[model samples]
Target: MPQTIAEKILQNHTREEVRPGRIVRCRVDMVLANDITAPLAIKSFRAMGAERVFDRDRVALVCDHFTPNKDIDSAEQVKTVRQFAEAMGVTHYYEGGNVGVEHALLPEQGIVGPGDVVVGADSHTCTYGGLGAFATGMGSTDIAAAMALGETWFKVPPSIRVELYGTPQPHVSAKDYMLRLIGEIGVAGALYKALEFGGPAVEALSVEGRMTMANMAIEAGGKVGLFAVDDKTVAYARRAGRSGNQVMAPDAGAEYERVVDIHVDDMSPQVACPHLPDNVRAVDEVAGLRIDQAVIGSCTNGRIEDMRVAAAVLKGRRVADRVRCIVLPATPSIWKQALKEGLIEIFMDAGCVVGPATCGPCLGGHMGILAGGERAIATTNRNFKGRMGSLESEVYLSNPAVAAASAVVGEIVHPSHL
Candidate 1:
């Protein structure tokens, strides 16, 4: 009857022991909805005749995806979210200057932490698992129900144990590690399952790196990607203003459906080819693949650490004459920090366009749209056809270091090659 970290958290909310595949109703610690998902959730809440959220403070409404409005339609969507947040007396609503990707923003602000069960209307909601929280995404309707009731039902997912070992080679980042795993597992390998990352290599990753890996776990069909609470998690939580949070870890005897071990020192920089996150290859194999653009920002890899990596590679260097590089900070706070640290100057001096903290090119909403047949290297998760523009265009996913170096060469190259 051993339990994984996710099971332990869910059981605490349910006040009972539970098993994978068992359906249970548990109190939701946090409920999140972004601009793209809030409107529908709001509509559903209204349809349910709910006049107020179960706990105003537990609900967060973030206007990020289309913030600063992409068009009249996007503006209208944001207005609806704004009006709903105001009427509900929701103190966690973030819009305008305070906006950021909800997954990244929530954890960075200490709204999510250890042992919490968070539900978000975003596929990347699983990102919170990096902090030892059991977070997952649900449809807007499910999010609406959670908002009204502060509870929801879940069919516990079986867990997959991922053990990591060895130190990563220089420039071999969490992003590359994730891409390699996804390639090995294929896109559907973990359908409806949890991926629990542990062991020495995971311990070596910074919180930002863990966040990047967890954020993309969904790309390989995982329900959630979790890491056991450790000093790194606690340090990050403290930095984000959290206190009195209890760390959670899987029982030593916890059963897993499968176990995969990765030796980080064996990994190289990796890239996910166009149209599929699992279509990955070593960076050296894809070197010199011409690219028209480079983007370094997303909930997955747009933290200050990512900026530092990109800055380190781009310092005193200029982007290739034919390449257009765009750098987006994940949040205004991160943007300010980068500015103070001269990372922003490094990007600017290298001819990279530094953008406001926004989803921007990640979702192809705006900023660096690709024309047909063009290719790009992006730090963002996802590389579905047309994800960054015309369906004929191609997207190759890499870590910030590789993306920055690629920008300098106008091709997919290893960061060390710069």
Candidate 2:
């Protein structure tokens, strides 16, 4: 049977070409560092008695978690990472507003691509799989080893096939389906596995929507979340400037430990209530849930399409006086495109605060702070207590349309109403 793109990336990096069921040691092609994890990784690499990296140019360090200092601790942490990146000669250093979220910035740089094994200290590193790379997250210790030796070991995880069979109804988004998946599989269900999403529903989705879905694979607690390298993947690669034709898909009889079937016709916009991603509810169930804010950006759904969707729903409509809406582009390149597309004007006219292209206010690093007992409806991934801003603040996770609609009404309402 032919292998999937995830399998090809793994095979290329394998120290030994064992069959699908066995474990293997691999020479990783790249390692990543972010503000939160780089300092610890650098410290551990030095303690290993390594004078310099195996190859400094192959490693990436991004200053995103605390850009321009959200508070005193973030500023101090930023200082530690900048000094470390400078001393180590790492080539990919993005600082202040110039820095996008770690996941959003790495793939844009052409450093990550097909048939490569990539590891990062951040959990969402699997976002690179959209390029046909086998990417996974690691702890500081694992980051240090990859940074020093450029290799790591991984058990070849058995695959699971998830099929979305029909076209979704109008106004539904990828985030909605992802939240519903987490609800079905449960948070701990897909642990240490690869989800190969296929069928018409998946192939029809745009690359940005596919990335939005794959990025949250970790939310279901899966190690490497991905889709087969179909035309959509190839087209995205070309547009992003990587320009490759190495898309891969598995054979009909390929082995999958599990198969999940999600029919698109029955699916609707989903909302993840506070505290856990898997705690998903339909939009109608929470129709009356009042919210204080709305956000439409993150590594998950902050791409250009996401911005356009919000702009379409908010044009000529004013934001509720009580609700604050903010839109952030995933990267500077996406921001530039959104500006070119005039989405920024629609948002500003709706009274939305368009933030710069950084991880700003996503993790409370900077921007969009909320007071105690407040509530927000956001398009970004994650809603753990205090994730957006204040610890006492509450967040409701939803698709961009729902978020925009809620912002207009100052309460939870379906975007289809307008």
- In the order shown, the candidates' Cα RMSDs to the true structure are 0.9, 2.0
**Stretches of candidate 2 exceeding 4 Å from the true structure:** 1-5, 18-21, 243-245, 389-392
Taking the tens digit of each residue's C-alpha lDDT, what string does model 2 give over 54-169?
78788888877666566788778778878877887878777865687777777666677655688999888887766556888889888998888878888787777788888888
Give the alpha-carbon lDDT of every model: 0.91, 0.80
TM-score, every prediction: 0.99, 0.94
> For each candidate, how many residue pairs have backbone atoms clashing (under 3 Å)?
0, 0
lDDT of 1 by residue, 247-362 (tens): 66789899999999888887899999979999999999999899999999989989999999999999999999999999989998999999999999999999999997788788
Q: How accurate is candidate 1 locally (lDDT)?
A: 0.91
TM-score of 1: 0.99
